[model samples]
Target: MEDFRKKLYEDIIIKQISRNNDVETAHKCIETLSRVVNNIIDSPNDERKRRLKEKSKTFQSNICGAQGGVEFLVKIGFRAKVIDFEKFYVLEHPLTDNPDSPEMEKLKVAQEILQDFLKKVKDRAELASKMQAKEKAAEELRRKAVLEKIDEDKERRVAARERLQARRKSQEEQETTINEESNSADDSADTADTTDTQSQPEQFYRAYHSSHYRQPNQKQD
Candidate 1:
């Protein structure tokens, strides 16, 4: 199929170009027309994009059929008079329904075959872009949620530490009061033990002296 299109492109299209329409212009025109046709093929019948291939196909069929005076030139092989162009150029655009031209059939078949693939590519590109945008939004939401959770956890930890410090300080003050009371009790016990020991010795000495007959010594004096 491709080989057939190449043959038509080279033999018919290339041959049609002349001093009036240089080969460069012929290339430019063919390329431009191809881009336009491809654009029509890429567009869909959907509301987002318009379809124009069917109309373009009809026009292209006429253009290739007329062949810029190449068809009849092939017919007579250099015997085509300039008068043939003047009259027959009209016939080529509105082809006389000639079935023998394989070039015509090849062109029509290529257009029909490309139609489906072009539409598929166009729709796929649009769908892919939509999917990407949706994914981006989801990712942003997830990131925000993660950051919020982290901040909440940090605040909770800070609050817990502060509560723990307050509890520890209160317990330390209670322990200090208990230790001071214990020291005061120990000091009082030591003072009571010292007074009891000194009073016991003095009471023993007075008892001994009273037992030694102090009344007799006072009568002698």
Candidate 2:
């Protein structure tokens, strides 16, 4: 509830001064430790968690509030020093010590445990960033390739459609031409038949008049 940011991340251990002396500083120190622990707990980086399990990477672990650690610790005026992470055990440090002892050895141990977790997470950050960059590059290349293929397919479909339409039009024209030719032939045949029928009737009538009219001369004789 109080302003804990003043201490950054440290538990109030045995100072050279009395415990009651600089009492506000002690409360703020507790607040900072609480905040820092929460931040480490909810890390956004997944690779950090993986590395922590495998113990695959090297890190300069430390006791926070000591010296020679990350800038975040140094900025807060603590004597933090980075040490070998293998020697530190988070389970044994912060939670297991006697709370009311005059020598706050437990507080110092908590600081060390907290620092190790930070180092582990920070070590994996650079690698995760590089991997994300590589994945982004690959995705961009794949997107461009797919778009190009789609364009090529669209062009091919358009060309095929045009060819089919032209072929159908050609067939229709050929059919129209053949039908017109057939109609013309039928018309010519009908005309010839009509002309022959008219001529035969005319010739028969002329022959009948000529042969019958010859009997008129016998009456005069």
Q: List the residue pairs that clash in candidate 1.
A: 66-92
What local lDDT score does residue 34 receive in model 2, on the 0 to 100 scale? 34
Q: Write the per-residue lDDT of candidate 2 for residues 122-199, one digit (tens) a residue.
A: 454556667779999999999999999999999999999999999999999999999999999999999999988888
Off by over 4 Å in 1: 1-101, 112-116, 185-221
**lDDT by residue for model 1 (1-221), tens:** 66755654445444553223433344333443344334323432222122122224433443343344334223312122234233222112222234445534543543443344334434655676788799999999999999999999999999999999999999999998998988888888898998888778554445457547677557553
Show the colliding residue pairs in model 2.
Answer: 61-83, 65-79, 66-79, 66-80, 67-79, 67-80
C-alpha TM-score for every candidate: 0.42, 0.40
Residue 85, candidate 1: C-alpha displacement in angstroms: 39
**CA lDDT for candidate 2:** 0.44
